[model samples]
Target: MGPLIRPLRSFANGLGLAWWARVQTHGPDVTYWFGPFVTRGSLERELPLFLEDVASEAPVSIDHSCLRCRRGEPFTIPASDG
Candidate 1:
């Protein structure tokens, strides 16, 4: 086990899907917001403030920032898939 982020573990478990199961099903469009970041067989942070954004009625922007590397990694995941 790793020093997995507890909120993520609980949230992922709440979805009733294994870590890899989500990947196989949703692939890269996998919303880490309220989704899991599995680290070495365990989970990490459950995307703080992300779920709130998801539930909000306001518009959301994915390209607002380059989150992962903060360098805009030049990757994109389509919203239609989500």
Candidate 2:
């Protein structure tokens, strides 16, 4: 695997559970934050596409109250998605 994929896979494996992933924008940059994810393979498969979309958009911010909710808990819905 490439450098990016390696780290992503490692991160997912380290979590040991599914979690939600969200894109947070700041000025010209974007941040990817993780939350309680419902499906295992969903984020893994869609991550690349999601990043591409974010890149194309340049700068966009999503307002989510649950950005850090249930951070370490397992099998819980992210506040943002709820």
Candidate 3:
């Protein structure tokens, strides 16, 4: 039973799809912390629409974090080995 349940739990955690609905309904704010691979411009452009979609039920705060390059823009950095 333990072995069977572990796989199911891992799969569920990996999916993380349920959180979207849950957050939309319950969260006042959603913070998405991403690695340095995602572009800031893309996020800035799309986040408003995403927030609007999620806020169809109620308003919620949306925030995120990413690398900053010399130009004071969102930048991507490779993950450290350690």
RMSD of each: 12.0, 10.3, 14.6
List runs of model 3 lying over 4 Å from the truth.
1-37, 59-82
- TM value for model 1: 0.21
Model 1 stretches astray by more than 4 angstroms: 1-36, 39-44, 58-82
Q: Write the per-residue lDDT of candidate 2 for residues 17-66, one digit (tens) a residue.
A: 43556556655444455544344465566566666766676655543222
In every candidate, how many clashes are there? 0, 3, 0
Report lDDT (Cα) of residue 34, candidate 1. 26
- Tell me the whole-model lDDT of each prediction, alpha carbons only: 0.33, 0.49, 0.37
Worst ten in a row by lDDT for model 3? 17-26
Top model number, lDDT: 2
- lDDT for predicted candidate 1 compared with the true structure: 0.33
Ranking by lDDT: 2, 3, 1
Deviation from native of the Cα of residue 37 in model 3, angstroms: 6.7
Q: 1-82, model 3: which lDDT tens digit per residue?
A: 3556445434543554111111222244333323221235644565566556556746444334333322212222323346
Q: Quote each prediction's TM-score.
A: 0.21, 0.35, 0.31
What residue runs in model 2 are displaced by over 4 Å at the alpha carbon?
Answer: 1-18, 28-37, 60-82
For model 1 the local lDDT of residue 29 reads 32
Task: Kindly list the per-residue Cα lDDT of model 1 for residues 1-72, writing each as its tens digit.
Answer: 356656655554455442421111132232322233333233224332543454353433231211221111
